[model samples]
Target: MKKLVKLIAILALVSLSQISVAGDPVEKKSEMKMDHAMGTMDESKMMEHLKIRQEEMLKMHDLSNKILAETDPNKKQALKDQQLELIKAEHIQMMSMHHPKMMKMDK
Candidate 1:
């Protein structure tokens, strides 16, 4: 009888622990709500960001073609330099736009 009681207590404790590991339903619901809100708020900004990325990709493709067609080493180097500068500027702009808080913290 004592062994049976101990077994039942252990089983109850294991089940309770599993339930705690499953997480709180109320907290999950609130997190879902917050995610939904953020998704809606950022939908337009996300579209704009995607469009900017596509444009940058197109520019890169054009620059690559120009580099491939150029016969002069000096001119090719100049084009490569321009591409590098453009990429750097774009990176800064992207960081400022998407992570303004982090950029501010850097200062």
Candidate 2:
């Protein structure tokens, strides 16, 4: 999960650097506007949700690792069940965050 976050940040930086290199004035202006709008939208709503999702995913990953390493069958089953519930909740949360109205507002 940390690696995934790092990769996304790296990609964002690379893309922004490329934008600065563009020579076309109109293209740069439009790109800047688009970037600003996206940043604003993310800061307002999506970024907070993403942070929560990232933390949840990290917890799920840790639970998975614990499940794999456990020797007792009963304990393992309990961990598996917990992980399944976490997954179901995560799915419902992601779906709600991505509703059409929210997405349309971002665009």
The most accurate candidate by lDDT is 1
1-107: candidate 2 lDDT, tens digit per residue? 85775565445333322121112233422322324444554353455434544555556567767877899999999998876666554443333333647756756
- List candidate 2 segments past 4 Å from native: 1-40, 96-107
- Candidate 1: 10-residue stretch with minimal lDDT: 15-24
Candidate 1 displacement at residue 57 in angstroms: 1.1
Look at candidate 2 and tell me the lDDT of residue 89: 49
lDDT digits (tens) for residues 37-102 of candidate 1: 455535665565455445555565567668767899999999878766655655554465457799
lDDT of each: 0.52, 0.51
Q: List the residue pairs that clash in candidate 1.
A: none
Badly placed stretches (over 4 Å) of model 1 are 1-37, 40-48, 105-107
